[model samples]
Target: MRIDGRARALIAADDRGLLYGDGLFETLRVRAGVCPLWDRHVARLRVGCRRLRLPPPAAGALERDRDALIAGAADAVLRITWTRGSGMRGYAPPLAATPRCVLALAPAPAIPVHWYARGIRVRFCDVRLARQPRLAGIKHLNRLEQVLARAEWRDAAIAEGLMLDTGGHVIGATAANVFAVIDDMLVTPRLDQAGVAGVGRAVLLDAFPKTRVRALRRTDLERASEVLLVSAVRGALPVRRLDARRLPVGPWAR
Candidate 1:
């Protein structure tokens, strides 16, 4: 763990991220000392900085931090977190503040090989995500909604949980973006309402020009011929079952 480009474990006690969760984070999959989709992750982090009204981390600094942490690990999960440094005793941010960047590396989760080919099971989370257009599409520090949703299921059979916005529109999975193929057309939930615009989903959309971004409902998912979940760290995974609905592993998931 490194704090603000230093080999430090302690952060300011009054940091807004610790006080009020005013921060953003990006997780990257490092393979053989490289973050393959780092450019895309940085692009997302830049947008997050703009939305959160904080200065972006220097490109050079970020690269150096990545190199130092992943030097020995052949495979790792690199998390880059940025917080609106120590602030006064209120919601209003200080006039002048230095953002805090913390880089943490950990062993990547070993996903079952069959999950990539045979797919996994999922269920709808009872917790509905609140619509916050300003915070939508960014991986913000405030993730209590996801936490609650994830806690809704503890069964090992359920690999992931799908979440919906308060407006009854399907948003995404607890930790991945959800994409579906309906009527022979590919589509994903729009992030303008609520959801993270993930790098994996972005790559998929870019690779498949016919993919559409729109509001999706439970019925849409029910009618989908195939469903896939994507995360920057976990890659692509097909959904073999959603609750009682048994789905098929699609060619696109490969």
Candidate 2:
């Protein structure tokens, strides 16, 4: 995809993101020409930059650039990527780095009206995310694990796939964070070791203060009263089935 004001055929050859997947990205839902969670996304991007030891760009400048990119789209998915820019021939980060930021806008995926009403089916993926506390809860560019997991299923019958960590703990879905209702309590996986803390998850937790974040096992998920997959673009989707286990629709599932 083209970035900035240029039509380069490919991403910069020397980009650290290309070399080592050293970058952070945010996916935001654009509704009616406005990004509702723009501030929160920007906050997370800034925090990710700090954690990665990268220079933060001017907020106004970045917003202006992003707005220009999405000005034509009525409803779209806005993705902003921040990389460590070009680097020398080594793993060591450069002392004087000019961070590269890319803003792109694309059409949002069409959501089936019936799927939202009847809930969606999901399956457990075999790909296990490696535990890395340092990178936990951040939307980093290293997504090979998710890419692999998503490829496991080609059937249109399955809507999403839930993922677990190496420790066999339920972390999240392939492309979204998971939340479930157990014993009338809202529970979601704690992203202390794996998984990206999704922006939609943050909004739900903030909206419902009683929601709890904790480590969940496979058994806990199976016994949950309701399961929901959440993402910035998809909002909250009820889970109908996971693998061979069939989950019944409940009031909480709504």
> Per-prediction TM-score, please?
0.98, 0.96
* Residues 1-254 of candidate 1: C-alpha lDDT, one tens digit per residue: 99888887888899999999999999999888889999999999999999999889976998888788899788999999999898889999988878999999999998999999799999999999999999999999999999999999879989999999999999999999999999999999998978899999999989998899999999999999999999989998999999999998977776
| lDDT of each residue in 177-252, candidate 2, tens digit only | 9999888899999999989998999999998899988999999998897899999999988888878887766676
In model 1, how large is the Cα lDDT of residue 9? 83
**Which pairs clash (backbone N, Cα, C closer than 3 Å) in model 1?**
none
Query: What stretches of model 1 exceed 4 Å from their correct place?
Result: none
Give each model's whole-structure lDDT: 0.92, 0.88
* Top candidate by TM-score: 1
Indicate the TM-score of model 1: 0.98
lDDT, residue 167, model 1: 99
Model 2 TM-score? 0.96
Cα shift from native, residue 96, model 2 (Å): 1.3
